[model samples]
Target: MKRKVDNSYGIIPFYIPSEKIVEKSKGCYLYDSEGKQYTDFESGVWCANLGHSNDRIVKAMEAGIRQSIHHGYKFRNHPSEFLSQELVRITGLEKGSSVFLSSGSEAVNLAISMARNITRREKILKIHNSYLSAYGYGQITPGNNHIENVHFNDMQSLDETNFGEIAALVLETGGASIDMVRFPDYAFIQELVELSVANGCLVVADEVTTGMGRMGKWFGFQYYDFLPDIVVTGKALGNGYPVSAVTVSAKISESFGKNPFRHLQSHQNDPMGGVIGLEVIRTIGDENLLNRCLDTGHYFKERLLFLNAKFKQEIREVRGRGLMIALELDNSVNGELVSDLLFERGFVIGYKANTLRFLPPLVIEITEIDKLITNIGEILELLRQ
Candidate 1:
């Protein structure tokens, strides 16, 4: 028999298909072509926070399509207006205005651009192991690197060094690693923010993955004490839609408004995208999803801890908060093998750097959580045998 092969070639092929192609999805479960259901822990690359085919999001998309879809970058519309207002209110950035974009990468670029234009500096500081975007200006430069990398744990005398040449200090709220989910050290983050203020460097936070209630908070920055000059958010912003936004504080916004800035995309302020964003936020608030995340996250971590305790030799550490968790298994356990075995057992998860990352939907049920835990336990036992 000739096996069917996918013609799509551009993707990184990080997780090659091990079973039937996914046909449809609803809530936290995905249905494949053969009608077999699998639990989704990755949330379609961490975007489907409200779950798959959410009624609210679907309805919003339908109605938004009827009303208006895209208004050129120059004109403003109701969906974008309401979305911006809601985003400001949800993010608790009272004096900040939102600019919609298509993806996290776009938002990151725009935020970096804003930071550079406002401070008139080229040197951007970033923490080590933080992911902004592959194509984002945060790390990309033509010749000499303009971005400075700082280690979160090894900031020995960074504060003493002069940051006069730095324009912005971009940061990812939580540092993700193969061994553990590393939330930033509070005192270290505070020092960085304080130094940024003292040195006149704009602080831009890239909340591409940690925002939209993923960290059991409205935004990841809320976990800390300071507010960033610019906040770049995406991934779960539209709950699976291709949407993102860069939020600028009133102070920096005014500075950019004074001058002519050249940045625009065809789908910059699409009404459908706005509607999706609005509905997703509304659903999260109305559904009390934040509290739910805290509750379910506690339970999920408990189960993971129990598993780690039982499989001490195979598991190295369990880290992360809320639904964003990771299982750092021992080196002997092939991460890809574990991923493939779990996938064959009707479970879907993320594997990177010998770690099994779990980013389940905020609406995931207790039963689904149990299914994942049980399958993992079975897989480990089989591996042991």
Candidate 2:
């Protein structure tokens, strides 16, 4: 596994580029070009729920490719049709329909577009710190008149908001963007939904990172009481493959019938994307990964809590739901250094500012978690010394 060429020469550096060239990934481990094994605790950007190179998903993809890979928007594919039905059923949408796309950004933007079209309004509401998409109206930008920000758990902000011209309220329960992992207050979410609906504004759940058993459920919105008019899912939906879906409730779907909404993309509703998404859903159900995620997530959180207790001065708080856990370190501690040390010890996790994020594959075993915990404890101890 030797590097044959400089990989970063022609590529745009989106974030800080990693020096290591990963040659292979299997299950929960990655093999670098130098043949070094590193545990992938972040699930390859929080997408590989079933693990890297899952046999079932790969096989299904192969089968689908043999049938049909890409069909233009003029014609629909069988895999997309079946996937839409399954998505509707799983999301508990009443007579819902789905549209598949390549990335979370597109799905989210499309969902917002649908909301605006149905309500015939321009304004979209989003939580202050929640990250919905990479671009378009979903992405928060200064001077963006179409978007409005409401503070999470702040009743004053919600009450002050004039929902008169609002089209939809986009909600992201898993706050991976702001502070690694933060769940909103249950009461606030309930009240927010009620207010949005009462004001004729649709509710959109941005479950890009929180969907497909990431939060120990089919969707993050399930943790709350209300159902979203539109549900957007990505990340774990494709098991590392590029696929996303926007599922709309019967009401929203029916609105499109009377008031047409046209969306066209090159890879929209591709059969391969549909097959991969379907297989990911089916595999999670057949293998019972949701319950497994809950069990492993509990055990993992408990171990992290033990470390937190042991190093109370260094660790700040442990929070998150299911496998989407986060360890907030003391302000004095350098989270980037801790993450770098973990990488040196053959573990790959995510760090932003003072938070260490963990989104491991659901198939990860207890022993692997134990290894990570042991390493984390040792790292914290060393930092203290």
CA-lDDT, candidates in order: 0.83, 0.90
Residue range 314-375, candidate 1, lDDT tens digits: 99988877878888899988777888889888888988888998888999999999988998
RMSD of each: 2.8, 2.7
Q: Count the backbone clashes (under 3 Å) in each candidate.
A: 0, 0
Candidate 2 regions exceeding 4 Å error are 1-8
lDDT of 2 by residue, 200-270 (tens): 99999999999999978999999997889999999888999999999989988888889897998999999
| Candidate 1 structure, TM-score to reference | 0.93
Off by over 4 Å in 1: 1-19, 139-144, 160-162, 175-180
